[model samples]
Target: MKSMTSRAMRAIVTVSLGAISTAAFAQADYPTRPIKLIVPFTAGGGVDTVARIVGEELKGVLGQSIVVENLPGASGMRGAETAVRAEPDGYTLLLSSAGEAAVNPHLFKNIKYDPSRDLAPISLVVKVPNVLVVNAASGMNSLDDLIAFTKSNADKASFSSSGVGNPQHLAGELLNRMASVKLTHVPYRGAAQQVTDVLGNNVTATFASYLAVASFVEAGQVKALAVTSSERIPSLPSVPAMAEHPQLKGYDVTNWFGLFAPAGTPGPVVDKLNKAVVQVLSNPVTAKKLADLGSYPSPKQPEEFKSFLATESEKFKNIITTADIKAQ
Candidate 1:
């Protein structure tokens, strides 16, 4: 009986060590198989575009084929959850946006995975800020003027956004809180009508990407008030950042993209992935492509990206709670 028990214990230890050694050898080789890059959006969308472009470049760097798969649903949470549950073998990766990784858990009640816990951060791919624009007819020129208008004419001062829980909606709510003003939110199905209403003076203002309403802005049909980034962007250098105002200091928001793998993936695997991404993002042609879409390629290592995600999660939670943002 004693010999049998001792044999059982040794067998268990040997099996455990074998498994660990196998995993370690697998991690050392890394992408021995084709990698599945999941983009939680429809094809041709911004997130999908990022996935494809970056994946194409990463294939060369990693010497493996990258297959970009779209898994769009549940405002991107479905795909994020899928990636979170994937085997942590570095073969499955998620190209996530702010919506899925930062805001969805706070916005949706039934989120299956906690982004900070389930998704291991590799790098932040890009940052795209929205321009807060008002109808030229409204005569609200700067952030100060807009604040004053919303305070005095709260009923009339309103901002249109694509959806209820999107970044645009949160940006408006942030202004309401920090500036102590109430600009009524007008949610739309998409940004096209939102921009149209702003131009028609049916709505006072809307937060849109500069590229989305660049023609109107250039044509003087819409007035640019401020950008939602921490500092003014070079594309619209003359406009001030939202954080520049005394009342709304530290106000910054943007649609950012990042790369993540499932939690429990080996540290060495994550490090190798990050190195490939850093090299890929520096490609001149790839940088140019992202730049044309108003995206700045910004890469950070695992630790730094982990910190950014934490800060962003906290900030998003505050905005959603204070503004009572909900998903439908």
Candidate 2:
């Protein structure tokens, strides 16, 4: 019996050593092939664009090709679920926005993965502020005018968002709740479509990323009312923030994009990815490009990003619960 027990312990030790050796070898030869950065939205949107730009820089930094794969559906859940289930070898990553990484868990009834536990945050890439814009034909020029109009025509006025349970949608809901108004919601397939519908006057207003509607606003196709940031954006200084409005006492909503790997990724691999991202975001040329698109680099440490995500999750959970937003 003692001999059998000794043999069993020896077998276990050999297996453990083999596993450790395999993991170390895998980590050492990490990125033996191309890495996939899964963008949870379709191509030609802000998230896709950001992924391409950052992927280019990452390639140069990491000496490995970064392939961006667009898998759009279920308001980004399909792609997120894919990444969450991927192996934790640092090769597969999710390039997701605040809606997917922070907001969706709170709104959806049966999310297959939890961002807080199923994934590891590598770094925060950019912070994009959404603006409230109206079609030029609407004649709603300033924040005051729009507020008054919505207040008077609460039942008639409607606002469009990228989708239900999106950050933009939640922003509009926050405004409606705070201002004591009943502005109707119109959900679109994506930000591009939302911008189109707003510019076509199909909806009274839209909460959209500035990148999606900046050209339209500049071309006089749409009128910018207020940004959803705490301060005015440099590119659109004339537009006030919702927080500045007396009716919106503490309104603040901004969209963020970050890189994340599957949970259980080794610390060394996570650090490697985070360092590469920080270098890419810290470059002046990359920063300029992101800023040109109305986004700013937010290169946070991995742990810091993890903590921020936790807080944001709690915040959106409360907002969703209070607003009684149901998933579609």
Candidate 3:
């Protein structure tokens, strides 16, 4: 009886090994069909823009079509949940921003998926700085003027964010904490609406992704005061870094976009996807296109991105905890 039991266990082990080998082989030839890249934001937002840019370039390298599906809602939770529920076959990739992977998990109490547990970090695509902008006619030319205005007209001074718990919202909170101002946060459904309100002067200001606000600033529709980065971006060379101000001495917030797949995806498949992403990002045309949109290619290996996500997760957690941030 003991001999029979041992034989059964050995047979099970052999079958398991065979299955693992087969799956690895399958992953080696990944994306037999069109891969779906999910963007967890509305169309024309920074996330969607990055998805389309990378998706188009990725197809050339991977030799498969990439379908960018926008599933914007729930402070980016709905799309994340959808991606998490997808099969771990490497075909369902998610283009997630800092808020979805780092900020929202801590801010939302009833979040359906934990990014660290439910998603596999594929690559860090780009890091775009958030800009502080106001309507060109707001007559608030500099960060100082805006601060003074907010301080004096506390009730009327408002800042718009794509939504609560978004990196833009946190940047606003950081500014409030660091500058000792009381600008109210007005969360909008998407950057489009927020930009519209800010451009119309219906909102006092907005801390939004540089990509979302770049055209407006270029067209003189909005005036950019400062960027939420330690250094000024090349695209907006004249804009000063928020950290340069005495009031916001240590302020630094950048909105980063990265790729993720559902957890448990085969390592071989993840490696292939990462390789393809690296190739696409290294292309000069792709880099130029990204730069034109106020974003620069910032790719990282799968393991590096995983580690970076862990670091960002902790960083945002500290920010959320210190700011007492909550989703509305």
Q: Highest TM-score, which number?
A: 1
Task: Summarize candidate 2's per-residue lDDT along 133-199 as a digit string, tens digits.
Answer: 9999887788777778988986778899978888888898888888877679899876788888876
Residue 18 Cα positional deviation in candidate 2, in Å, after optimal superposition: 6.1
Model 3 poorest ten-residue lDDT run: 23-32
Clash-forming residue pairs, model 1: none
**Deviation in Å, model 3, residue 70 alpha carbon:** 2.7
lDDT, candidate 3, 229-309, per-residue tens: 888998999999999998787788788999999999888888899999999999999898888877878999998999999
Q: Give the Cα error of residue 101 in candidate 1, in Å.
A: 1.5
In candidate 1, what are the lDDT values of residues 1-328, reduced to their tens digit?
9999999999999999999999888888888879999999889877888788899999999999999999988888889999999999899999998989999889988999999889999999999898899988887899889888887887788999878877888999998899998889999977789999998888888997767777888899899999999998877889999999998888998889999999998899999999999999999899989877767899999999999999998899899998888788
lDDT of each: 0.90, 0.89, 0.89
* Residue 19, candidate 3: C-alpha displacement in angstroms: 2.7
If scored against the real structure, what TM-score would every candidate get? 0.92, 0.90, 0.89
Off by over 4 Å in 1: 1-18
**Clashes in candidate 2: how many?**
0
As a whole number from 0 to 100, the lDDT of residue 24 in candidate 2 is: 86
lDDT of 2: 0.89
